[model samples]
Target: MHCFKEKICLIQIATDKEAHLIDPFEIKAAPFFIRVLESSDVMTVFHGADFDIRTLDREYQARVKNLFDTEIACRFLGVRERGLGALLKKHFNVDANKKFQAFQCGCQ
Candidate 1:
């Protein structure tokens, strides 16, 4: 899940059945989706998230009651390896390709 400013530009939502991308540029899912996200019962998950969470509160005027931050959990567990890439390799033996990380928002 990634966002630019207050609006989420790209979101990858998944379940046991399937997964889909909600591109606000192409779809009008923000208003409804933001309501769902603001629900106290809904737990939002993120990996090493920081500003995104703050932006949701500051810009979107929304609050997430339950948040599962992988980095925070790792810190709680006292794990020396905290990066998502390192954790994936350590636990699941998967290598994450960080190709899209270098891309800037609105970049061609």
Candidate 2:
């Protein structure tokens, strides 16, 4: 989850157990989540953010105030990159190998 300006973006990577319990109703009723959506300065998330925004809108009637796409950021940065792993390797000097790189793909 991240907030920027008045927008809030939440990323939920569910494990097998947690994934099973996931439901639209529970997502809406989660009190803490509602609070985050209601009160945030800004939100920045990457690819497929629309899906998340749609789900939040459908379940809780929440609306994002401001949004920044990290994938777009990488492009604007002119690093000739697309995925998080490559960007991380370029900017953060992290050695994200093929195995871990594949795992990082789901982040966006």
Candidate 3:
């Protein structure tokens, strides 16, 4: 299934000082958070934003403002590998969990 068809089980947000994982299923303040996404002052950054932006609009009717897509930036910067997992590993020495790798990008 495409990303639009997939349920957003979690929403991950990271800052310079902290990271947070929010379970959409468990949250009562989802509307409040959606408002935050729609705010022009809050710049929301995404690795590969095409699907994420579409999904947000489809699911929450939230239109994100002031978006900075890093994958596009990497492309313009001429980074050979543009995938999030690859970039994270190359730049941060972090190994992303592979358990969900097989399920990504509408792979059967």
Q: Each prediction's Cα lDDT score?
A: 0.74, 0.55, 0.84
All candidates' TM-scores?
0.77, 0.44, 0.85
RMSD of each: 4.0, 10.9, 3.7
* Tens digit of per-residue lDDT, candidate 1, span 8-49: 446776667887887657877667767877778877778876
Q: Which stretches of candidate 3 lie over 4 Å from their true place?
A: 1-4, 101-108
In model 1, the clashing pairs are none
Error of 3 at 91 (Å): 0.8
Select the stronger candidate by TM-score from 1 and 2.
Answer: 1
Question: Can you write out model 3's per-residue Cα lDDT over 53-103, one digit (the tens) per residue?
Answer: 888888899899999999999999999899998988999999888686335
Best by TM-score: 3
Spell out the clash pairs found in candidate 2.
Answer: 4-42, 5-41, 5-42, 6-41, 6-42, 7-41, 7-42, 7-43
Per-residue CA lDDT of model 2 for 1-108, tens digit only, reads 322222223344343456333333335546655555555574544453666677677756776656667877766778566776777778799976655222322233
Better of 1 and 3 by TM-score: 3
